[model samples]
Target: MKISNETKVGALAIVGITLLILGFNFLKGNKLFSKSLVIYGTYENIEGLTASNPVIINGFQVGTVGKIEPDPDMRRIQVTFNINEDIRIPNNSIAVIAPNPLNITKVEIKLGNASDYLKNKDTINTVASEGLLDDVMKKVDPVLYQVNKSLGTLDSLISNVNSVVDQKAKRNISDLLANLNQVTASMVQSAASLQSMLAAETGSIAKTMNNVSSITGNMASNNAKISHVISNLDSATGKLAELDLQKTLNTLEGTIKELQAMTAKMNSGNGSIGLLLNDPSLYRNLASTGNKLNLLLDDIRMNPKRYLSISVFGKKKTAEPLMLPQPDTLNAPYIIVDKKNN
Candidate 1:
C-alpha cells in the first residue's frame, strides 16, 4: 500500500509513544504481559514510601507499590501494591517498610500460616519499622540527655566552687599545700634514714642483724646438746606422767586429816600432852614434886648414913631416920627444904 509521509510519521510517533509508555511502566516494575495481584494496606505513616518502590518476599523483589493515598475517614494512609499472580499471599500476611543496604526502602512481605489465601484487593496487615538511624537515635537520646544534664551540673558545680573559693580559702589551700610539701619532705628524709639504717655493712639495724645471725649460728652449733637436754626433759616428763599422783595426794590428804584431828584433840585438852600443855594445876604439882626430890637428894648427900647403913654391927642401928628435911638455914645443904617438913 502506498502510504503518505504524514501517515508514516504519525504511525512512527504512535509506535514511539507506545514503546515509551511500556518502557516507563516496565521501569516502574509493572508487568505488562502477565497478570498481577493487587493488595491494599493501611498505615499511619508511610515513612517516605512512594510508588515504584519494590515489594519483596524474603528479600526477593516480587512487585512494586502501585499507589499511596490518604484516607480521611480513618485518618490513615492506604497503600496499594501489585504482586505476581503466581505468588500466594496468606490472609494473615504482614507488610512492613524495611530498610536495605543500598539505602533503598522496600515493602517486605512476612508470610503467615493461614490456610486460606488473600484475594486480590484485600488488605494486608502493615507495620512501620524503624530505620537504623532512627533506632540509633532512640538509643542515644537518653545518653545525650544524661550528658547534657551532667554538663549542666558540672557548670553549676564550677559556679559554686568559684563562689566558695575566696581569697582566704585560696590562702588556706596554699598553706595546706605548703604543709603537705613539708610533710612530704619529712617523709622522704625518714625514708632515706630508714634506708641507711637498714644498710648491710653499717647502722644499728645491721649490727642487730649480725648479732642475730651469730646467735643463730651458736644455736645451730649446739643443736645436738639441745636435743639431748630436750630428750632428758621428755624422759622426765614421761616418768612424771607415769607417777600415781592421785594416790599420793590421797595419802597426803589422809595424813593432813589425821594431823588436823590430833590438833583438834590437843585443843580440847583430852590427851596427856594436851594436859601438860593446858593444865596449870598439874604444872604446879610437878614443880612441888621436883623441889621435894631435890631436897631428898640434898639430905642424902649431907648425911649418907641415913640412906645406907653399911656398918657391920647388925646394920649399925640406922641413924635416927631423917623423917623430915632440915630447915632452910644458913647451914642447910638444901635451901629448897620446906620449913613445915622441918
Candidate 2:
C-alpha cells in the first residue's frame, strides 16, 4: 500500500530528531541502554575538569561526569556523576580527579570498606590528585633553576676570560709552553744520561756490593773471636776494678805531699843543693877552692919534693901533709893565667 507523503515526511523528521538526540547523548558518554546510578561530589577546585569526562573505578570505565556547578556557598564546586547501576558505591567512598597515562583527566572512585551503599544522588567525598603535568613541573623546577645558574656562571666565566686575555698574554703563554717543552726534553735527556751512567757503573756497584757482603760474612764468621776478645777485655777491666784503686791514690797523694814538703825546704835553702843554688857567696867560695886545689895539684906535679921527700938510700921522709890553701885563709890569688899571655 502507498503511504501518504505527509505522514512519511513527519515520520522521517521524528526519526531524524530521535537519531540526533541519541547521537548527541552518545557523544556525551551517556549509555542509553544500561541502568545507571547518580552520585554527587564537591571540590574546592577542579583542575580543568569538565562534563563528559569518564568516571573510573579500578581502571575500568563505569560512568561519566554529568554537571559541574558552583555550590550555594560559592567557595566549593559540586560535581554530579552517573555510574553504572550494577557497580555499587560504598557510602564512605571517595571520588578523586586523577590523570590517566594517556594524559586524560578523569574522576576515579576509590572503593571503601563501608557495608552500606550510597543511594542515588548521595554525596561522595572528593580529593584533588596531582596530575602528571604537576609532578613533572615539580621535578623540573629545581633542574631548571640549576641549569639557569650554570648558564649564568658560564656567562660570567666567559666575560672574565675575555677581559683578562690579550695578545701579549697569549704570546707569553705560548712561550711558556715552549719553555716547558724544552725543560721536559732536558729532563728526559738528563734521565737518559743518568740511566746510562747507572748502567755503566753497574759492574763496579756489584763489586762493591760483593765486597760489602764478604766483609759482613767475615764479620759473622769472626763473631765468636770478637766475643772472646771482648770477654777478655771485660775480665781485665773487672780485675782492674777489683784492685785497691783508692789505696793507690792515697799512696800517690802521700808521695806528692812529701815531694811538696821537700820542694818547700829546698826553696828555703835548707839542703846542700838549695844552698848551692841560693847562696852566691858559697858558689864563689867553691870556685875559689876549686882554683886553689888546681894550683896545689899543679905545684905538686911541678915539684914533687914540695909535697913528698923521698930518700933513695935512707928512710923515706913523709912530706908535710900537702896543705891545700883554703879560700878564706889563703892570701895569694889562685887564678891560673894562660901560658900564651905570660
Residue pairs whose backbone atoms clash in candidate 2: none
lDDT of 2 by residue, 1-342 (tens): 999999999999999999999998899889978867999998887777889899999989999999899978889999999888889888988999886567667999999999999998889989987768788999999999999999999999999999988999999999999999999999999999999999999999999999999999999999999999999999999999999999999999999999999888888998898898898677777766677677676567656875566667876554554445445435655654333533
Q: Candidate 1: where is the Cα deviation over 4 Å? A: 1-152, 162-204, 304-342
For model 2, what is the alpha-carbon lDDT of residue 71? Answer: 72
Give candidate 2 regions above 4 Å deviation.
Answer: 1-160, 271-273, 283-342
> What do the candidate models score in CA lDDT, each in turn?
0.86, 0.86
The numbered model that scores best in TM-score is 1
